[model samples]
Target: MNLTKAIAGRRSTRDYTTEAVDEKLIFRLIDAAVQAPSAMNQQPWTFTVIRDQALLERISQEAKACMLATTPVGAHSSHFQTLLSDEDFQLFYHAPVLILISGNEPNQWIVEDCALAAENLMLAAYAEGLGTCWIGFAQGYLNTPQGKHALGLPAEWTPVAPIIVGHPKSAPAPIAHKAPSIHWIG
Candidate 1:
């Protein structure tokens, strides 16, 4: 598929089918994610794939509780609140597959590298007729002790992003993209 089409088609899917995503497909998505650019060629990243139903449920519950605790009263940030519904709070659309991305501490550009990886994965999933939502709200929960145990994250790996993937239960409509703000030298 062309890059334009993929870009136009990609959306943050919040509803997903219960159908299981193939392991091979998940790996393929990761393969695509690694293709993203990193600073100084330093690829400091790790991924934790969660497929166990019980574990996913636990993570979801823990995450929701964390959100409730962290969300300041009356503060509604779309990235942290609007996307987290009762049904989608922790598991995030219950997509049956969740990809947890972490980065090494020493790399100053870990955040950028991890974000690029996430975009690559989301777009790749869309191209493959799958749906994905980049989940950043989970950071609050994942930063805690329970979250760390749930994902089996190493002490050295900091959570950068988590993504939920599955077949779309509802197709996302195209959203308007803002015009680029740039100053070009002739």
Candidate 2:
């Protein structure tokens, strides 16, 4: 697929089939991710590919519990609370793989850098006839000490993006986009 088409077609996939994403595809996406631009060319990024569905389930359960314990009463929106409180809710949406983007070292632009890499990964997946979603629900938990231990991440690294990739059960319908708003001075 062309770059413009990939950019326009990519969507945050929430539903996926049971089929597992291939290792080669995961690596290909990671390679594409690293090709993204980094601040000062400092590519301080690491990709953690998680293929075990059971582990993902455990992480989802634990993360949900942690969030429930920490969230202030009434702080979350009703829908969010319902989602988190529901034991049936799977944080990764049952996607067969999670490609976590992390910082290899501390830097002012680490988050931004990793985020750029994440976009590349997502677009690459879209181009590869795969589905991907930036699982925001997994980030906080993945960054915690327990979460880090579970993922076997190095002590110094920081998790920035928890992206799930898999085959979609069905293609998501195109969502309508609002016109861009810009303020210009020149």
Candidate 3:
């Protein structure tokens, strides 16, 4: 797919088939992610690919529990609280692969850098005829001590993005997007 098409057609896939994504494609996605621009070229992102079904299930359950135990502070929090409470909810949506992006340093731009990489990964996956979803709900739990140990990530490495990639069960309808507000000053 062309860059324009990939950017315009990429959607957050919530449901996926059980087919496993190719390891070569996964590496290509990571290569695309690293191509993203970073502040001062720090490029401090680390990609952890997870394919264990048991671990995915455990992380989903634990993440939901952790989110539920926290006090809701706003409408966004309240919405997540409701979603996490649903017994059928799985954070990774049963996708066969989960890519966790982490930052090695506690730098101010680490999160931003990781986010850029994640966008690249998603767009690349879409271009490759794959589905991808950014699983933000897993962030809190993945950053916790227990979660870190479960994923075998170093304590200094902060989890930035949890993305699931796989073949879509079915094509999702195009979602209408609002026009962006623009301001220009000369």
Candidate 4:
């Protein structure tokens, strides 16, 4: 697929089928993710793939509880509150795979680097006819002691991106892209 096409076409997929993503395909996506550029060539990302259905459910419940408790602060809290409050809303959207892109070591650019890699992964999934969504709601829980313990992650690692991948139940309907705002500088 053309780079521009992939950039414009890839959408955050929320609706996924029950079918699991093949292990090989998941690795391929990660391979694409590592190709992303990093600040000072510091490839500070590590990956944790979670396929356990029961575990995902537990995380979803815990994350929703955590988000509900903290929703009183953020500007967008009310919006998320509604979704988080839904008893039926699964944080991973029933996706068969949840891949956590984490920091290998702390650095100012670790978050940015992981995010770049996340974009690469998502785009690659789109190219491969898979769907993905970066589940920000899961981040807080995933970083907590319990969450890390659940994933068997070391204390030094921090999960920056919790992306869920699967076969989308339906192709995403086309949506409008906002026009870029330009400010000229010489």
Task: Give the per-residue lDDT of model 3 (tens digit) for 85-155.
Answer: 99889999999999999998888999999999999999999999999999978999999998999999999
Q: For residues 1-186, what per-residue lDDT tens digits would candidate 4 score against the true structure?
A: 998999888888999889989999999999999999999998999999999999999899999998898667678877898999999999999899999999999889999999999999999999999999999999998898988998899988988999999999988888987999999999
- Native-vs-model 1 lDDT? 0.83
**TM-score between model 1 and native:** 0.87
Candidate 4: clashing pairs of residues: none
- Alpha-carbon runs more than 4 Å astray in model 2: 72-76
Native-referenced Cα lDDT, model 2: 0.92
Residue-level lDDT of model 2, residues 27-46, one tens digit each, is 89999999999999999999
The alpha-carbon deviation from the true structure for residue 45 of candidate 1, after best TM-score superposition, in angstroms, is 0.6
Which 10 consecutive positions of candidate 4 have the poorest summed lDDT? 70-79
Q: Estimate each model's TM-score.
A: 0.87, 0.95, 0.96, 0.95
Candidate 2 residue pairs in backbone clash = none
Q: What is the C-alpha lDDT of each candidate?
A: 0.83, 0.92, 0.94, 0.93
For model 1, residues 4-48, the per-residue Cα lDDT tens digits are: 999888999988889999999999999999999988888888888
Better TM-score candidate (1, 4): 4
Give the deviation of candidate 4 from the true structure as CA RMSD: 1.2
